[model samples]
Target chain A: MSPETTVTFHTPSTLDEAFALLKEHGDDARVIAGGTALVVMMKQSLVVVDHLVSLASIPGLVGIDVREGAVHIGALTRHRDVETSPIVREHLPFLSDVYGRVATVRIRNSATVGGGLAHADPSQDPPAALMVLDARVRLVSPRGEREVAVAEMFRDYYETVLRSDELIAEVIVPIPSATARTAYLKFLPRNEDDYATVAVAALAEVANGTVQKLRVTLIAAGPTPVRAEAVEAALEGQSPTAEAIRAAADLVADAVDPMDDFRGAPDYKRDMAVVFTRRALERVLLAQG
Target chain B: MQLNVNGRTLEAEATGLATLVDVLRYELDLTGTKEACGVGVCGACTVLLDGRMVASCITLAAQAQGAQIQTIEGLGDRELLDPLQESFITDGGFQCGICTPGQLMAAKALLEHNPQPTEDEIKHWMMGNLCRCTGYYQIIESVANAANAARGDR
Candidate 1:
């Protein structure tokens, strides 16, 4: 059995206070948002901490807005808010659909955009979509602030590039061009609420019978959200014929490195990744009226 | 810490790690909220925190300190059953009865959010509240019936 530990909780109304609490608690402190994932880890003793500094009380950390050709989503914005936001629905409806499929409505109500990114689970839904959308997370700390592309956020399974003192302040997603169609496909063979066995997100712009631009990303297929760059390279400049799409989608089989779990074996997930990628590609490229 | 639970302000001495479910059940004797899969996956501990449905088992009491927390106990009693409770009983929404409170709370949240939700919307909203008895069809019917009853469509 693990040793018993009494935890202290702090709800700091400002980043300065939160930073000071982090300094006071040092390595024993952990930043909490929504507490959907972190609290579960705390209960199961997967992550033990002496102090939990909450960002809920902090102002200016919640809301969504379109500015400078991008959707600026506050770190504290809940998944449900993003799913239901008219702006997100109108500007990034595919993203809204992806957020709506996360876990369930109850979980979405409490899980925040930043918290989910900070949790950095490879099986999560948003990372693949965000990567395909070319979203970037603005991170803040007592030291200063910086932005990192969503494609570079994850380090490993359940690990991120976030420093202990740094918090994700906002996620800025560039609105895709009106002509670029996007699709997100999650293979949930089990419960609807369960994580995807292998998920795929694809965005493409086709003109004059040629693929002008394309981006593809996947989840639950690797240690981090895997970008199907090879697949993108093969199709971006070519006509998205069925043969071309199938050949490009087949490249994802060699791209992902999945672990064996109840969801599927490594071999099975790789196949599903290819299958879903193909399906998503067809939705964006060929299924149009 | 002081909590605004079910429209009443109460003091609780739960530790920082004590989840809202723990405080509501152990300290305040509001045992209507259950904990099955203690990790937020199972919606057995579903509650309304500041009018939003959340898994109380994963929400820290400290996190819910100032929020208006509503548990199953607040959803009316034996003398006056909530409309959802009435619908569940009338529609046979449960078999083993383990997931009833959560089903009711989640249904209540759904009806509050969308007073006239379609069958698809109800199913989507109540997807998190799992029923091992496979009483899903009845649960869905119950929520749909409740919505109809609220809107005088029954």
Candidate 2:
């Protein structure tokens, strides 16, 4: 057991109070939602803080609603909520599929989508899916609020552009076109409780039997979730045929620079990214048909 | 902090970041919830958080505040055991009993959520809780038997 330290815990009743706590504590305080990832890091002595402001007590931050033109998920919404959300199942099954496969049921029930994205683990599934979906995150601080694209939110390995005093309030995801199809695939040594060796999420729209638009993102193969623009370029304007998908998959091997580790070698992970991208594309294409 | 453990309310002094497993063993002296892997990966410290199975080793004690927590002590007394407990004893589901509490809690939670879980559903849901004894077949059968008992089938 680590030495006992005096750490103040503040559970604000409202968002304004939560922001005030963040503003008051600054770098000495950390916002805790679903402590799934943060608690583990704390136990490992990776991060130590004198104060923790829990966002779980804040109301209106645990619901998912699709209004107007976007799907808004509160920062405190758990992964299990996303996995079983009727709205997500009806409109964004790809996100649901990714959430269903994250960690395990125990973790999913407590791990929030905001915490997962804020942790910015390169091997995490949500960031890869959000990157491909071109999601936007809303950050709140005492000063004001600002929104940033998911792709730009990540700065490097296990790092995000989130400031110490800024808290992610919600994530706004633009609804995909009715013609669009998306899928997420990951490779892990064991099917349970293991991080992804390489994960791929692809979204594409087929029009007139030709690919009108495409987006591909790879995870665990780089410092952060990366958009495979080269692969997207290869697939756009091409027919949703096996040949086109194969060519797009081939482009991913060069687009990502994977690292060699116990999970797999760099070459193997890169090959897996290609294979996973191809399979995910094929699944989405067949679903459209 | 005051928590309703099993059926009784208890007050204890604990930090916000202290794990539920630590609260049970260290503060409350309910040592049934084992701590195998302190991380959430191992379900050896599984317990019921408001009747839902969760890895207590990873769950913060502060998170359990005002919530109902059920440990192995709440399952049954030595003389009178829950049906699931009886089933495990009869079906040889445990070898060393180190992971039994977690397994039973997870199985009990599964049964509560789904009375008649398919073998595949049980396998998929229980994948997070690992048993080094590798006696999953008997454990699954025990859970099924308990489910049957709960439904008045046996």
| lDDT, each prediction | 0.90, 0.85
Clashes of each: 0, 0
**Which portion of correct inter-chain contacts appears in model 2?**
0.41
> Largest TM-score belongs to which candidate?
1
- Shift of residue A166 alpha carbon in model 1, Å: 1.5
Could you list the CA RMSD of all candidates, in the order they appear? 1.5, 1.8
Q: Tell me the tens digit of each residue's lDDT in model 2 across A56-121.
A: 888887889998777899999999889999998887788888889898888887899888889898
Q: Give every candidate's TM-score on chain A.
A: 0.97, 0.93
Model 2, position B21: C-alpha lDDT score: 90
Each model's fraction of native contacts: 0.76, 0.41
Runs of candidate 1 with Cα error greater than 4 angstroms are: A1-5
Worst 10 residues of 1 chain A by lDDT: A1-10
Q: Candidate 1 at B57: error in angstroms?
A: 0.4
The residue-by-residue lDDT of candidate 2 on B1-154, one tens digit each, is 8878988999877886777898889999998989998888878898888776778877788888878899999989889999999999999878889989988888888988899998988888888888878558988888888889989998
